[model samples]
Target: MPRLFQVIGRQEPVATVSMTVYLHATSADYAAVGDDYLLVDSRGARGGRGFYDQHATIWSRDGRLLVTTQQVVWYRVTK
Candidate 1:
């Protein structure tokens, strides 16, 4: 799991957790592309100290599913 959490620097995650996307719905089909409005919704949670997780979904104006993503992150503050 460290392979998934490590990205940029040498920072390490002492604790971590995973989350799943709850809902993703679409109304219309956007197979033919031209121009359309994109909508997004997201929600997340934090352990209040070391880690947080979030997921988001993007949809076209006609309610076509465009993209969805979820991520877990570990962070620290230093000066």
Candidate 2:
């Protein structure tokens, strides 16, 4: 089984952006009975002039990696 996620809220304008994501588990990982799991997100930003990059990773309670993601955004400057 596959899960779907939706985000609903106010919309904001953004410049050019790129992103990559890796999901490292199947439904079985989530459907297991009597199993407790943990999720963690790590993020960072670098650069100036409204340009930055960020990354995040999700791990289980036992330090098993579940998912990883990265994204970059930058604005165009006009002279």
The list of candidate 2 runs beyond 4 A from truth reads 1-16, 33-37, 75-79
For residue 72, model 2's alpha carbon misses the true position, in angstroms, by 0.7
CA lDDT, every prediction? 0.57, 0.59
* Model 1 global lDDT (CA atoms, 0 to 1): 0.57
Quote the RMSD, in angstroms, for model 1. 6.7
**What lDDT does model 2 reach?**
0.59
lDDT of 2 by residue, 1-79 (tens): 0000011133333454788989887767645422676776755557556566768887777676777988776644342
Mark the regions of model 1 whose C-alpha exceeds 4 Å error after superposition: 1-35
Across 31-68, the per-residue lDDT of candidate 1 in tens digits comes to: 44347567877656443465667677877776667678
TM-score of 1: 0.49
Candidate No. with top lDDT: 2
TM, every model: 0.49, 0.56
Clashing pairs in 1: none
In candidate 1, residue 61 scores what lDDT?
A: 79
Task: Kindly provide the TM-score of model 2 when superposed on the true structure, using C-alpha atoms.
Answer: 0.56
